[model samples]
Target: MIRFLTYPLVILFLILTAVQVPQVFTNALASWQIYTPLIGGVLGYFVLSIIPFVSRNREHMITFSHEMTHWVFSLLFFRKLYSFQVESDNTGSITHSGGRIGEMFISLSPYCVPLFTVILLLVRHMVSRDYLVGFDVALGVTLGFHIGCFINYTGLYQSDIRNVGIFRSLVFIIGFWLFFAILILLSLKSDMYVACKGIFLRYWDTLVSFWQFVKGLL
Candidate 1:
């Protein structure tokens, strides 16, 4: 069952974080320069989370991106969007009643794409050490944009399909953070690296399918 797999991943994440925390603190003490990337990423996530309370306009812009993510995925899978809407509360959904697989892809695409993109950009900037001054601001902008769209659009928080208990919730959080860490590691490789190329290709295929589907509709 999903629960069985979820708990162990959570436990593993907790163990990893426990092991990493001291190292993170030690590195921070050694040099703020070394720790700026981590700080920037955390700050970025925090700022994006608060956009919902700022203004309707900001929320709507994020909502537009969220829906577009779905639309893109839908077209990638060659699914027709029967209808779609971005509401005033910054919520949006695309209806592809005929394409169950396409709908699933649309739902999952945002989770992988935006999260990975931000992690990649942050890691590249960190390693280059070229934009240390604006790292946090850049991170905040990207994180805010993605997180705002994620919370507004995804069923992760709202749907009843996955009734994650306290332990599971903790595990889910840990898994998400660990995934980000993995993404950072992956981003360190050259663009031609197998792992990097594989991920990009998969997303590209999905995106292309979504685009083609949209074009067909038009």
Candidate 2:
């Protein structure tokens, strides 16, 4: 019952975010080319992923990353945390007080988002353009780390996805990732700000047109 209901709600949430978050972003990058320093970061991330195959602590680190992401999302959603721990058996958990919706978001966030990636991206903003070389490297590294972690975590047993139902989880994940990606791009490319505004308008128009089409049949 709750699972089925969450489907439409997830769609509505995505539609709402798609129509709104892009509005506040007043910047965009001139180009999407991968900068050289970003390659450094990417390489670092790739190396880390491969190293895990031979490392003894890889499982523990991944578990820690997963749990830490939960904690981060908990904090972001205004949740109060009473405890968090990572066990030697490569298991971890967090106890936090939050709304049901917030709890749902917290559980699934790590799967779609790499907390470290966001942290590095945020840190990149603080550095000057003159120093962006280093920042880009860090960005690539974090991006790669996100990719690696996402790949590893997706197949393993995930309580988050099961709780929401896989179909709904995938829908929400797509929406969440799309929203964040657009937001990030818009924040970098100010020139596209106007186009960004038009984007959701077109999307809404399409939805409205579809609804009308459906109604004409009935």
Candidate 3:
């Protein structure tokens, strides 16, 4: 059942965070740098996707994705959903009830996390670690979908942002995204420890050097 899956999913999330978060902290760029090609494609797709004619028709898709993201987190956290809806004109909402942590994730997910990409990554992870050929294409497209929809929807004021203070919203969204980004990067690489250490030693040294130079100037 869906509820049963939540237990496993939570474990998976924690395991990933344990390895990837510290790795990213030591070397933040490693989390995203390897995805440069795929990210470029995703960004390029975003440019083409935002043309009014292209975007207008896809409004419903965007709206559905937004609500579905909230719905997903709600389900993942075992929250109760009262209702979910998406209109033809790219407008939608989901009503759910849960604890503070779940409430934050359910309300703020649309702006920060890409549910489709996360879902795709999960599907890929479950099926085969190394057998997924051309997985990058699927990953890029869903990532583009997330970026495009995130840009369009977040331009307006949403009730979700108001519920969580703007500062808290950015911190939560960014911190959550960084955690998973590291996980995604680790999965793509053969040497995760090297990647993690790269962040800590190489990047840390560069940062320290930069700081020392700045101090000399002062």
Model 1 lDDT-worst window of ten: 183-192
lDDT by residue for model 1 (1-218), tens: 64466567557555544444454345446665543555576566666556766553676766676667667777888887787899877677777645434343355455434643555464653454566446545654565566655555445564421444545554554445544444433433322144445444544665577689999999
Q: Can you list the residue pairs that collide in candidate 3?
A: 26-199, 26-200, 27-199
Task: For candidate 3, write residues 1-218 as lDDT tens digits.
Answer: 44344444444444444444664546546466656655665766677677898677677878888889889989989989999988766678888776745666787888878777776666664556464545655677778888777666673277787776565565566555665566556545534345455534644565567689999999
Provide the overall lDDT of each model, using Cα atoms, as 2-decimal numbers: 0.55, 0.70, 0.66
Superposition error at 78 for model 3 (Å): 2.0
- What does the lDDT read for residue 14 in candidate 1? 55
The residue ranges of model 1 lying beyond 4 angstroms of the native Cα positions read 1-35, 41-58, 100-102, 111-137, 148-180, 188-218
TM-score winner between candidates 1 and 3:
3
Model 3 whole-model lDDT (C-alpha atoms):
0.66
User: Model 1, 129: alpha-carbon shift in Å?
Assistant: 7.1
Give, for candidate 2, the lowest lDDT window spanning 10 residues.
Answer: 21-30
User: What is the TM-score of each predicted model, taking all chains together?
Assistant: 0.48, 0.70, 0.64
